[model samples]
Target: MKRSKRLILLPHCVLNQNAVVRDLAREPGSLSGLVRVCLEEGLGMIQLPCPEFTYLGAERPPMDREEYNAVAFRQHCRRLFAPVLEQVTEYLARGYRIVGLVGIAASPSCGLFTTHFRSGEGPGRGVFMEEVLAALEGEGLSLPSLDVPLGYGVDAEETTAFLARFRAFCGGHP
Candidate 1:
């Protein structure tokens, strides 16, 4: 059988709630609904490293984007994404289509937009995502991206909206 040759970059917590900060994990397991859609669409998932978990560990307190925006943390994001960048390039070389990135909407380190801050949620890419985008940009590559809000799956309505947006991102024939 022919391979699907399609992929999507994802933050680790999306696939592993175990990596989330204790109080913030809303799901009992992986986001099954999201995963189901991806599988149905034949989009392979690239689970990126959990920068907060790896840098601060699972037991650490919830932190915000400003707190994680230190020199060392930024450095770590760069180091951690190196191999992922290589993997993306390899897939590109092999003719795989990277559909886009799916990021947590309210994360401190992995949010693509609407990140947490000491004050409250605000708009911006999380620390780790900044590095990922920069690295990809340096290589002249960019992926269309979307965010699954923290409230995702809390209601059928929200989930429906995200799925619709996801389908549009996946594209279609002219």
Candidate 2:
């Protein structure tokens, strides 16, 4: 067997909708289109933990970034990402090229490019992503990342557009 030496980091919810908040999942189990595209492209994937789900549990309500923006939660994000960071580091050390991150667009805990707040949506990294990206940079591993709506798996046209951009930006040349 051979290896591609390429992979992307994904939020746990991307692979397990059961980890998402009530009535917010786009698919029954996984984001089928996204997963299918990844599989077709032969890109490896590393599903990162869902900070909110792990901390607040499946029954927890969706929260705004401000509400989740506490020192305690920040610390928790770092704690949860520690092992993931180790895994990322190990992969890099073994010569694997990182394809980057794919996160929920408006999630308070995992949004990469856009986040949610009481007032409305805003541009920023989520608590978990803030920690994860910083940790990766501390190790000199700055990778590309993007965010999509919670309903990313809903429409094919949007999915195609998003994936094209994602691949062009985050794929190739690692």
Q: What are the runs in model 1 whose C-alpha is more than 4 Å off? A: 172-174
10 residues in a row with least lDDT, candidate 1: 165-174
TM-scores for every candidate against the unseen true structure: 0.94, 0.92
lDDT by residue for model 2 (1-174), tens: 798888889999889999999988888999876787677667888999888888899999878999999999999999988998888889889999878788889888899888888887898878889888889888888887788765567777787777677656555322
Q: Please give the RMSD to the true structure for each candidate, in Å.
A: 1.9, 2.2
Computed on alpha carbons, the lDDT of every model, listed in order, comes to: 0.87, 0.83
For model 1, residues 1-174, the per-residue Cα lDDT tens digits are: 878999999889888988989977757888877777788787888999999988999899988888999999999999999999999999999999999998899788888877888888889889999999999999999999999877676878888777777767766321
Worst 10 residues of 2 by lDDT: 165-174
User: What's model 2's TM-score?
Assistant: 0.92
